[model samples]
Target: MLKAERHAYLLQQLSKQGRLSAIDEAERLGISEDTLRRDLRELDMAGALQRVHGGAIPRPPVPASYADRRGDDRTRKVSLARVAASLVRDGQVFFLDGGTTALCIAESLPVNLRATVITNAPPIAAALIDHPGIDVYLAGGAVAKRSAVTVGTEATDFLRRFRADLGFIGVCALAADAGLTIPFAEEASTKRVMIEQARRVVALAGSDKLDIAYPYVVAPTTAITDLVTDHTATEERLAPYRLRGITIHRQR
Candidate 1:
């Protein structure tokens, strides 16, 4: 097949499967693995897909800013948020990562349920203002304007002071192989600290974020104890995470 046709075929496969194995696709296309690797490389250079160790996954969508992403897939975020909120115990201490979904999770918590929430996002802290039973601690640092989250050494160091019962990580992209990834470097650092300080890590991702990858990786799939996503996620797509011993919670 021509190079253009081959690229189209690969892209089509990615749309259907959300992931592509190099050897399998090469065999299917009646080409050598080396040739397929070259095709994947070209596609990666063109920003079509992200190539992983032995396969490729879709590139994560990058909205203009956090403000823009607030309205994108709002319902799905709420659904995942509800599932995440259900995991909270009344007296547990939780680390809330920054993102629109994290805000939803904060809002979804029961009014009278008492808990301590440490977060890097001011918006999430503000959302919990009326929750009289909940204690909110906003991390201090340089806030990234794009994500509206505090990042840097100061934020990460602040998180080290207390151990949390659960960490609700709002990931930009999640894949079995690539794990959890986000676009910015300093935010990734802050998230890493959150994961480290928590006993259990729960990732809140939308269906669109599944099987996709981004530039900066926060943690491997094994790092997360639970994954909460919308009902739109297929069982086939979630099988990998389940096999990794992550409890899956799908929105009803």
Candidate 2:
């Protein structure tokens, strides 16, 4: 068969079965394994599908802006933040990721809470100012206009200074195999540093982010200690991560 025919077949099979194995597909297409891998890699780079450990999974198509996201899911964000806040204990240091969800998490902290917060977002730093007992540290860097979060070599360099007790991560996408991903490479770089420096990491995501894959890979699902989500998530949607030992904390 021609390459176009093979591509069509691959997409059709993935649409029917949800995932595809290169070994099986190569045999079915009567193609060599190396050529099959090249095709799959091309497809992956073209954003057609996600190449996993041993197969490919359908990649589905973010919150576009900071203000829009902050205002988008007000109630659900609050609920997710409450779950994130519950994980915080007195005197523990935190690394807060930038986004509406992290803003919600920052806002949800107890007013009398005593803790140290280190973040890369200016707005997140500003939001935490009213918490009487919490000390906020803003990582210095040139801020990105789109997300209003600090990004660049400077930001990641600053984040490396402290080893946080807990890290609050927010993402545009989350998948069982692709892990946590976002669209911006700069943001992804900063998030990787946050995940590396934290002793424990808690991911705050909406149910809409689940089972989805974004372009830039931040960290693997294994990096998260706990996942705080809203009521929209189902057990089936969460089972893959749970099976891999990542704890899921849905809305109570």
TM-score of each: 0.95, 0.79
Location of the lowest summed lDDT over 10 successive residues in candidate 2? 60-69
Tens-digit per-residue lDDT, 54-140, candidate 1:
989998776569899889788878888888999999999999998999999999999889999999999999999989999999999
Model 2 / residue 202 / CA error / Å: 0.7
* Cα displacement (Å) at residue 236, model 1: 1.8
Which segments of candidate 2 are over 4 A away from where they belong? 1-59
The superposed Cα distance between candidate 1 and the true structure at residue 241, in angstroms, equals: 1.4
Clashing pairs in 2: none
Model 2, 221: alpha-carbon shift in Å?
A: 1.5
